[model samples]
Target chain A: MPAVIADGLVKSFGDTEALRGVSFEIERASVLCVLGPNGAGKTTAVRILTTLLRPDAGRAVVDGIDVVADPRGARARIGLTGQYAAVDERLTGFENLQLVGRLFHMRTAQARSRARELLERFSLTDAGDRAVKGYSGGMRRRLDIAMSLIADPSVLFLDEPTTGLDPRSRLQMWDVIDGLVADGTTLLLTTQYLDEAERLADDIVVIDNGSVIARGTATQLKSASGGDRVEVTVSDRDDVDRVPVVLAGSLQAGVEPVLDHAARQATLPMSSTDHVVPRVVRSLDEAGIDVVDVVVRRPTLDDVFLQLTGHRAENDTDADDDDSTSAAVPEGAAR
Target chain B: MTATATPTRSGPVPSDRHVVPTGATWLARDTWTEATRHLTATRRNPELLVFATIQPIMFVVLFVYVFGGAIQIPGFASYEQFVVPGIFAQTIVFGSAFTGIGIAEDMSKGFIDRLRSLPMYPSAVLLGRTFSDLLRNIFTFFIMLIVGLFVGFRLEGGLVDAALATLLLLAFAYAFSWIQALIGLSVKSVETANSAGFMWMFPLTFISSAFVDPSTMPGWLQPVAEHNPFTIVTNATRALYNGYDPGMDVVWSLVWAAGITVVFAALSFRKFTSNSK
Candidate 1:
């Protein structure tokens, strides 16, 4: 049986349908990354699977227990780390972990030992005695994850674990997550960063507007989005307008190349870039366009978003509010 | 799926060690653990405790020194003896507002979300908070009691009566904390919770018999003051503290405390458990 299953989960907040028939499964001891832009129902889906919110339709099963029918049993098997660092600022790091351990029904001695172990595991042993209010943002996040792992839950859910971390802290967080993956823990991670999904996820589930638009390995997703692309950067600004026309003639009769006028570049999707690169460059040169560079590359997840939804997957680093209830703005809607 | 799938190791899993205590023991342990979380936080932030006591201390000093001579009750010799118990009831009841503020703060910070996801009973969070607030109230009550005595207030009642009176006031405060919990869960932000919590309290505490005799109020407002739960509790505690017969006030005050507790606990628990909506 799968370690986690979210089958046709549907939830609505009044007039807003936050999730519309979302479904996925995670095999035991593997990671599944739910990737989406802001307000794409990633948090809503995670909440449902974690038994935080009851779905209006369908069901979720975690570690062989039905989440709705036996939420307590499911709760005993899973742990959650939310978007915000949910540690009590007044409590020390060790105290925070100890409190969580006790709440998880660990005996006092067991709780204390587990607290010490987790504090050291997170490299917070020296600062374990100090209040969390004095800790850095990175320290708080590590402690938050430590608190979740206190009971050693079979399944762990991290909701945008590095959403607000600095670049260095985010890398550190990635290393921490890497260690968890090494421990063979079943993880369901939600993230807006495509690279995070690529780096950490065993399988990536791409959600948009409350639906799974695509799902697979990173390479599978890139291939499914479209094969390779021939990108040309022209030297002159005026040459940008003519680069696409030449590429269209050489590639196909009516295929339109994606244009970036300001960057002086145009990208055209092609199934095979081997035979077409030189011909495309020759065509552009004949059209009197000064080609600065020509490169062949596979599509990024950003390109996959554009292919599937007609817009780039926007990572809202500026948005500080929890995204579970963010408005379900349509793809490509103005920010 | 990625290429880094680790070979499933053979070992004892963490879930195997989980032996959840059944029924009442589980509830008791969970509630105590949750309460300990808040109490430890309170101990760490002594400045918060000091500030919490400061307001009640000021109220005791202000009423006794600034407004004491101007106000008089018919039966009592000095206003300090009559008003001190009222302040006790008022200060503790006012302290119940922290219950709402704390709940709202936890909710805003997503700590409530963390608790909800845990395996413990849902009641533990609310019970733990109110329990910690009760302890904090007891601490504040002692400070006020000391300050009240310093300002010429005396406990003329026997030790048993004084302790019972103190228990009744704390019970009423604990009951009020449930109502505050409901308010805290209803508000969207901590700022809103703070204002919503204290807005109606000023009238609830002042329009009653906390400072002066209810009979001295305007004719129309007199019945409202006389019937306020704060008045009943104040009247009960004051009678016991001043060595007077409490008549049926003690029974009535207990009834109010029990009734508010049963009704508001039901409401607050429902609000807290179903708060995902």
Candidate 2:
């Protein structure tokens, strides 16, 4: 059986329908990332799955227990880390974890030992005894995740786990999430970052305006959107205008390239990049248009989102490089 | 940090669905856990404890000397004898406002979401909050009592009467904590909770017989003061402290405490469970 299943979940707050018939399933010991922009019902969906909010009309089951029918039973099997780090600012990190352990009904000695182990695992041993108010944002978030894992829950939910972290801290958080999945724990993660979904999710569900717009693996989604692309940057700003015409003349088709006038760059969406680059470069050289750089690039998740939704995924700020001309990142064994 | 530390999930799971206690045992355990969390936080922040004590001491001092001679009660010899008990009642009631403020802060910080997602008893958050605030009220009560004695106030009743009065005051304040918990959950921000929690309390304490006799108030406001619940509690405590028979006021005060606690605790828990935000 699937470890987690959300079926026809519909929730509304007064006049606003936050989620409308959203559904997904996560296989055991695999990660599913619910990708969306702000106000796209990502949090509402997560809240419903974690049993924090009851769905108005639908059902969610975690580890074979119905969330709506038996929330406490579902709660026992799942742990949640919300968008904000929910650690008590006034309590020490160790105290925070230990307190959650006690609430889970662990013995005092067992709670203490588990707290110590989690603190060490999260690289928070030194800061365990100090109040969380003094810790950095990353430390607080790590402790927050640790609190949720106190009982070694079979299913864990991290809602926008690294939404507002520095790039360095975000990388660190990704590594920690990778380690958890390595232990064969079923994970359901929600994030707005497309790269985050690409990096961690075994399967991706993209939602917008409270509905699932697309769902598949990263490669499948990218391929569905389009194929490879060729980007050319000219040395002179004036050369940008003539480059697209030259490319159409060389490729022997009516090719129209998207141009960035300020950057003197033109990008053409192509079905195949094989042998297209040399033809374009030779054409540009014959046309005497001073070329700065030319390269072929794979379609990114950003392109997929733009094609699916007709708008770029919210802020795609960090994924900006991947959209403009970046080589495919090497796949790591960790995630 | 090394990501290679094999995750703890490799070990046997320690606790799960079957281990969770049910009914009263579950409620008591989770309430105490939450209470301990609040109390430990209070202990670590000495300034919070210090400020909680300071306000009551200030009220005791200000009322005893500044308004002591000017205001007089019909049955009391000195205003110190009457106003000291009133101050105690007022201080504890005022202390209850923190229950709302703390809950509002927790809600804003998303700590309530964390607790709600847990498998623990649903009402424990409210119970724990009020319980810890009640403990703080007790501590503040003693400080005000000491400060009252230092300023020439004396208790004429037996030790048991005095203890009973203290319990009544604490019980009444505990009920108010539930009301504050509801307000805290209703308000959007800590700033709003701070003002909303104490906005009606000032009039509730003053319009009653807290600092003076109801007979001394304007004729139009006398009846409001006479029937006010705060007045009943203050009258019960004041009579017991001054060695007078508390009469039906004691019974009525206990009734009010029990009624308010039952009604508001239920309301607060319902609000807590259904509060989507």
DockQ of 2: 0.43
Docking tier of model 1: it is: acceptable
Measured by TM-score, the strongest candidate is 2
By DockQ thresholds, what CAPRI class is model 2? acceptable
TM-score of each: 0.89, 0.91
lDDT of 2 by residue, A1-335 (tens): 99999999899999999989999999999999998877889999999988888899888999899988888888877899999999999999999999988777676667888899999999999999999999998999899999999888878999999878877788899999999999887898998766788889999998887899999997787667665667788999998888877766433233235688777888776656668878888889999998889877655545666779877655444544444433332221112
In order, the first chain's TM-score in every candidate is: 0.83, 0.87
Per-prediction DockQ, in order?
0.42, 0.43
Which runs in model 1 stand beyond 4 Å of their true positions? A227-232, A242-255, A270-302, A311-335, B1-15
Model 1: DockQ score:
0.42
What TM-score quantifies how close candidate 1 is to the native fold?
Answer: 0.89
lDDT tens digits, residue span B81-163, model 2? 98999999998998999999999999999999999888888789889999999999999999999999999888899788999
Model 1: colliding residue pairs: A202-B1
